[model samples]
Every structure is written in structure tokens, then in C-alpha cells.
Target: MSGIATYRHTQKAPLGLLVYAVAIGMFLGAWFTDLQSVSLILALVGALILILGSAFQQLTVEDEDDQIAIRFGPLPLFRKSVRYDDITDVEVGRTTFIEGWGIHMSPRGGLVWNLWGRDCVVLKLRNSVLRVGTDDAENLASFVNKRLQTEERE
Candidate 1:
């Protein structure tokens, strides 16, 4: 209920879901294990994994008003927002495998908010660069470029 959502996409990440499932399995295994100490440790670690997985199971990008908001879903512990005016350019690009999945600093420079794939839309902002990973690279790029155009016209 903030600005009119011009574009919204949630990148599905089965790998993320799988990671969460594994964490739940670990939790279950903890109960059946004979070693009490090991079971306690396993349960603690499983809880951590579960939190991370829920926090970043998917990535949602919304282009609304004057900014593009990026969020990691389910638990949404991480998020970012970039103003359209702050962005100088947008380019469709590919992230290196080293970057992998999840949010992190890109080896090639800048920060990356990726949910699942290697495809991304790189936004060169006034003070920073953000590589927003997306499965629908073409459409996201097109939508952003068009938004930039509209801003330039005004």
C-alpha cells in the first residue's frame, strides 16, 4: 500500500527451499540421535540454518514510486531500496558462478542481492552498484530501462 507497484517479481528458488528442508531434517534427526551433546549441537545448528533459509528463500523486487525495493522473503531479514533518481544506468548482465546464490558482495565489485540465478540487472547508482539477480532478466531490464526513460523525460 505504498506506491503503485509498477513491477513486481518473486524469483522462485527451489535450492533455497531445499536448504530449508535439509535444516528441518537436521532438527528431526537431532531428536532421534543417541548422543545427547551432539543432538543439542545439531538442533542449534539446524535452527540457524532454518532462520537463514526462511530469511532468504526467495527474492522479491518491486519497482514503485521513485525507488526499486529488493527483499529476501519468508523471513525477510535482508532488504534494499534504490531510488530511481539515484540510478544512472541499468544493464542486463550475468553474475559469475563464484558469486553463487544469496546476498553478498560481488567479487567483480559492488553488492549483489541474488535469490537464485546468475542472470541479473546491474544498477549503477549515484554512489553504489547493485547486481539484482533475476530469472526474468529481459523483462526486468526492460522495465527498469523504460522507467529510467520516463524519469529522464520529466
Candidate 2:
């Protein structure tokens, strides 16, 4: 583990997020009749959109010495690490739009750490599953697989 080669992948916020934010604002403004409250609500919603767009905008995958670490951008609140010994299998998979973003439990089972996109690296752990959404799904899966192989030899 001393000379371990680390692999990292980062995802940035896509343009679609801005569009979504605008849609939310429009809907909120239309639903509320009070001009003062509507303005306040709009500001709050705008701030929320900015926070979500920036705070949870990125996902980083790292191959540490003996574990794979996944981090959601700028926020320490959504970081997780799984040791090689605990991972049973890793594969490239797809997630439906219904799954959405942020750190949450996937309907399919286990947790899903996604920033954007449907491509993901699904990890089957000893007792549970974890899906890490990434644009480079194949490379992430291969990286994990290689690490697992190396760990098995040791």
C-alpha cells in the first residue's frame, strides 16, 4: 500500500442544473400571488439553487492506499471510503433519471453518490451495494477492479 497508484475522477455541474433552477423560480413566482413574499421566496430559492449547484456540484473518486474514496465537491458532508477488502465486485452501470442527484439511498438498494449523469461505478460490498456516479464509468470500474486484484494478491 506504500507505493499505491491513486486514480482520481472529478465531475462538474452540467448546464442542465441552471435550467432546472430557472424552472423552479418561474413555478414558484407563478404560484405565489404576494409580490413581497414572492420576491423573498425567489431570493431564497435562488440561493438554494446556487448552493446546490456549487456545494454539491462535483464528485471526486480517489484510489487511496487500501481503499477507494468518493467525495462530493466542496462539502465534507458527503464523503465515503470503502476498503478494498470489503468490496466484492465493481462494475460500470447506469442509473435512471428517477434516481436523481446528491447522496441518497438508491431505490435499487444501498447508497448512490452521484453528481450528474447516468454512468456509474457500482460497488457490491460484503453486505450492501454502493453506486458512484461518474462520467468515466469504465475507467473507474477498471481502476477499482485492478485494485481489488492487487489486494487479492497481497
Candidate 3:
């Protein structure tokens, strides 16, 4: 028998829906109401927030074989194996405050996954680079690193 293990990251559906609703409300209110600057500012901010929030909110995990992966939008970013054996080193770090969340060219890094909150694990792989984001990401990174070390010694 083959054993398969799956870890599904938390869904940001509720948050996404809420952002959508807020954006729509702001846009509609701007069109209907007389307040110009207030309406325009709220409308723009709401639209930006909706788009950015939707993009950043995501989940990441590894299967039983320790293959790390991330799911964003309707597609999988990479199918490559983030296995411990393939990973040379795993580091936990956060983006600088200078980098804003969501659609910015230079992401300084507060958090990539805005909905889930900022915390990421950088995996130094043999061939490529991989990063996984999560709220408890530091702990998760430590957990995986320790397990890999144990396996390596054995």
C-alpha cells in the first residue's frame, strides 16, 4: 500500500469575499455620493486593497514525503520537490517594512501572504529556490529542518 499525506493550507475565501464586498461598496458609494476626495480616496484604496489582498492570501504546505508546495489563484506556483533531502538549508525570515504587501515591484517584505499574515521559510534547495509563507511559518520551518537533520544522521 502507498501512503499519501497532504497538508492543505488555510483558505482565505472568507477574507477575499469580505474584501470584494468592501471594494464594491466603496466604488458604488463614490459614484452615488457627493463627497469627491473622500469618495475617490476610499474608492481607490478599496480597489487596491481588494486586488492586493486577493493576490497575497494563500496557503502552503508539504506532503508526507516533505515536498513543499504553494497554491495561489487557480494555479500551483511550482511542482518542484522541496524535500529535506533536496534542501541544503532552511532559513526563517521576514521582509523589511520598506516592502509593502501585494502588487509592488520591489517587495520589501512585511508579509507575502497578507491574509494569513507575514512569516516565511526560505528553502535553499540543490537546484532552485523555494519560499513558503504562513503565520506559524517559523515553527514549521524549524520542524522540517529538525526532521531533516534527524533523517540525515540516520
Candidate 4:
């Protein structure tokens, strides 16, 4: 892994998300003394947010050997790798907000592994397509293209 060229991208938690988390915590604290049922509900919602937020905290793109690897973190909930030989094309593209986030099937066909953002690098493989969301969409696509060219030469 030391020699491999890795492009790591991570998104800082948005201010809005932080504010929402705080609000949830405040509500839970305030209701703890009075309403047990309401406190339990808020606790569950807060837990869900914490879980999802941690899962979408970062994205990493790596070029290793002859394969392109993409991973979402701070948890390894979604990860994928495609060999240069298997990829037909790589293009920088955009994803609609409607597509949401996480690992999902794109409406246009293919799997989308995203943390949070519209910019993406789409990979057309021999059998299926894969979209990876990243802030450096162009750079990622260019890196993949260069890898494919090198693979073809060797």
C-alpha cells in the first residue's frame, strides 16, 4: 500500500448537521426529566443520525496495481474496486440531489457509492456502471484514465 497512489478525500461535517445534532441532544436532555416516551424517541433518532453521519464522513480513491478502488468511511460500509482491464471508460459527471447518498443503484443504471456531494466520477465497466461521488471528480476521472492507458500499454 505504500507505493500505491492514493487520492483521499474527506468532508468535514456541515454546520447544519452539527446544529441538528446539537438540537437533538438538547431536546433529549430537556425531556429526560418529564416525558420518558418522548425522550426515548429522540434518543433513537439521534442514534440514527450518529450512525449515518459516521458512515458518510469520508471517501477515498486509490490507484493500485491495475485496479481503481473507492471506499467510504469512517466505516467500511461501502467499498468497491474495478480493474483497469474491466473499465471501458471513466467520465466526470454530476449526481442529482434526488439520488441522495450512501450505496445505491442509480436511476440511469449502475451503483453509486457516495458520501455527500453531486460531483462524481462514473466508471463504465464491461458489465456494469459505477458512480463514485467526490469533490475532485475531474481529478479522479483523469487518474483513472491515466491508469487505464498505462494498463493498456503493459
Please list the C-alpha lDDT of all candidates, in the order they appear.
Answer: 0.87, 0.82, 0.58, 0.75
Model 2 misplaced stretches (Cα beyond 4 Å): 16-40
Lowest summed lDDT over 10 consecutive residues: which window, candidate 2?
46-55
Point out the higher-scoring one by lDDT: 1 or 4.
1
Tens-digit lDDT track of model 1 for 41-61: 999999999888888888899
TM-scores for all candidates: the values are: 0.91, 0.79, 0.52, 0.79
Q: What is the Cα-based lDDT of residue 133 in candidate 3?
A: 52
- Which candidate ranks first by TM-score, i.e. highest? 1
Residues 33-105 of candidate 2 have per-residue lDDT tens digits of 4687777777677666655655676788888787889987664556899998999999999887888877888
The collision pairs in model 4 are none
* Position 68, candidate 2: lDDT: 85
lDDT of 2 at 27: 58
TM-score of 1: 0.91
Q: State the number of backbone clashes in model 2.
A: 0
Query: Comparing candidate 1 with candidate 3, which one achieves the higher TM-score?
Result: 1
Q: Where does candidate 3 have its weakest 10-residue lDDT segment?
A: 102-111
Which residue pairs collide in model 2, if any? none
lDDT of 4: 0.75
